[model samples]
Target: MRRWLVLGALLVLVLLVLAPFALIVLNAVKTPQEYAGSGPLSWPSHVSLDGIRAFWTRVDFGRKLWNSAVISGAVAVLGVLFSLLNAYALGIGRIRGRHWVLAAFLLANLVPQEALIYPLYYLARQVDLYDTRLAIVIVFTAIQSAFGTFLLTGVLAEFPPELLDAAAIDGAGRLRTLVRVVAPVSRPTLGVLGTFFFVWTWNELFIPLIFLISNDRQTVPVALGVLQGDRMMDATATSASALLGIAPAVLFFLVFQRTLTRGVTAGALK
Candidate 1:
């Protein structure tokens, strides 16, 4: 009886989580009249692609998608690299001031982005990086790296001491051991962290709003914001565009969900 209750509860939870996405997708296939007339929960009477067509024609969605991909991919790669190096150093190197450094990073993470935006804006201007792809990439990487670094550090902390001793016995230098031994064992953690960076950077809105000046250069979230207006928005088209923007992240998670889950669990065990 208890097992049945648990299964039922899980099913309900899944439906609850999926409800909004179902609404979005269903609405995307409906005409504007159907969307505005019927409750979103109701199935469309007829399927149509008009919504998607309108969104594509109205918004430069292709360019925005590419911009978001480039920024998010760059952020994910750089964040993982920096995080791995930091984690390896703190977890394995036993460097001085490690605790203080970790504390500082955590504290900095606690500071809201709003508090630092003004300073970051000035700094970007000073360096002549404002309104540029590099600016977005740098800010995204730097902001996301703090938590990724912490996560990698914790995972590395669980590493078996025996492995390090074994590598040392092989006369492996610190860099070599990190590159060859630690990284291999830590790939799962890397994948998990990289996935996180990819999702967050792709969805990020604030920094891009502040720094991105050109509509052509704006990422998906910023571009979506531009799509909104005081006039009645094409409900179908907007939903379709949102679905498109979310597709990559959704696909990424679907593909790596297993590895990501395993890595996180393995790190916890270690």
Candidate 2:
């Protein structure tokens, strides 16, 4: 009876989370009038591809999609790379100021992202990287690395010192051990990190909005915002645009869900 009750509660929670997404996706295929007139819960009497077509054509969604993919991918790879480097140092290195360094990192993470954006934007301009994909990647990487390093550092701390010590005894260098041994065993953690970086970078809005002013270089979130202007708000088109925006992140999670869950649960256990 307890198990059944728990399952019932979980089912309700699932519905709560899924409801909005279902509404968005379903209404994306609906006509603007139908979407506006009908409750989100109502079934569409007629499927309409017009909204998707208009959205894609009006905004050059393909370009935005490509831009988003490139920016997010770069952020994910660079974010993970920088994070692993920091985590390995803090996790295993015998540096003098490890605790202070980590404390500083945590404190920095606690600081609001909004607080850093203006300075970061100015710095990017000074460095001749403003409005470029590289600039976006750099900001995303910097913002995300603190938390990523925190998680990766915790995972590495749980690693048995003996394995690293044995590798050193056999003449394996730090990079070798990190690549061959530490990384292999840290797959679960990496999965979690990758998923997080991808999702965050994909959905990112504020930074891109601040940096990229050209439509050709704009990300999906920014491009989607353009659909709502002084003239009108095409609800169906906006919904379709949103669905397009989230598709990549959703697909990534679906592909790596098992590993992601394992990584999350493993970290929880630790």
Q: Please list the C-alpha lDDT of all candidates, in the order they appear.
A: 0.86, 0.84
Give per-residue CA lDDT, model 2, range 71-164, as digits (tens): 8888888888888889998887746788888888798789987998899899999999988888998888887898888778876877888899
- Write the residue-wise lDDT of candidate 1 on 84-141 in tens digits: 8988889878689999989987987898989989999999999999999899899878
Clashing pairs in 2: none
Give per-candidate clash totals: 0, 0
What are the RMSDs of all candidates, in order?
1.6, 1.9
Which 10 residues in a row give candidate 1 its minimum summed lDDT? 224-233
Reference-based lDDT, residue 204, model 1: 88
